[model samples]
Target: MNLSTQQKLEQALQRLAPIHLQVIDDSHLHAGHAGNTGGGHFSVFIVSDAFAGLSLIKRHRLVYDAAAELLPSAIHALSIQAKTPDELK
Candidate 1:
């Protein structure tokens, strides 16, 4: 079975136990752009306790690590907004 990029991202990010998660596909917005052969562009908004006390870079690192296998292939680029639940309140 084949999984869509959004599905793949959701599955991979599950380890974070996010209180809220949203994956937006922005491929259409970049259509015809150079370097966009087949891979998709995405934006992720995730709220999880896992981000507590972590710096922005560290939070982004966690997100990148989870989605490492998809980089430059299934996913060409990613924009992430990772925040702790407390930070949202």
Candidate 2:
């Protein structure tokens, strides 16, 4: 029925077929902040072949496009580290 923000994010990112993926909820770190209303802050660490040949901005764009529906509501801020598997070697 209802999924947590992390779950939702993970589900959304699955489209990338990541070799490794981690979603960290950083909402608590910004607790009581002025701009924080109900949305959560998150960090994403992902490794996927999809990132190969893509620039940093393009990689982030892909991530953002996947999670577009959650922005400014289910997700307030997102920090992403996207890398290709080869880059990890």
Candidate 3:
């Protein structure tokens, strides 16, 4: 089977060094949603020490950095729940 949305998200996080992560593709729920024309919406649950000492906004910036061009184009909406491993534990 092809990699699921969660798997794809996991891969993204892993590529960025993740301590914890959960990616959920909620595309099915947004059939006619904007940007959902091709790809879909995603909820990213990520926790990593890489986020330590950074503000939430900065953490999101990092995610966007990692996602780069994929954001909004391939991923319509990304509900990012990012945290540091210390916060997760």
Best by lDDT: 2
Error of 1 at 44 (Å): 0.3
Candidate 3 structure quality by residue, lDDT tens digits, 8-78: 65676686688667787888888886535477788888878888899989999889788765665577778
Name every residue pair that clashes in candidate 1.
none
Using lDDT as the measure, what is the rank order of every candidate, best first? Answer: 2, 1, 3
Which candidate, 1 or 3, would have the higher lDDT against the true structure?
1
Give candidate 2's TM-score. Answer: 0.95
lDDT of 2: 0.95
Q: What is the lDDT of residue 8 in candidate 3?
A: 64
Q: Which pairs of residues collide in candidate 3? A: none
lDDT scores in order: 0.93, 0.95, 0.77
**Every model's TM-score:** 0.94, 0.95, 0.80
Q: Write model 2 residue lDDT over 1-89, tens digit each, in one string.
A: 98999999999999999999999999999888887868999999999999999999999999999999899789989999999999999
Give the Å shift of residue 27 in candidate 2.
Answer: 0.5
Once model 3 is optimally superposed onto the true structure by TM-score, how far is the C-alpha of residue 68 displaced, in angstroms?
1.4
C-alpha RMSD (angstroms) for model 1:
1.0
Worst 10 residues of 3 by lDDT: 4-13
Q: Candidate 1, which segments miss by more than 4 Å at Cα? A: none
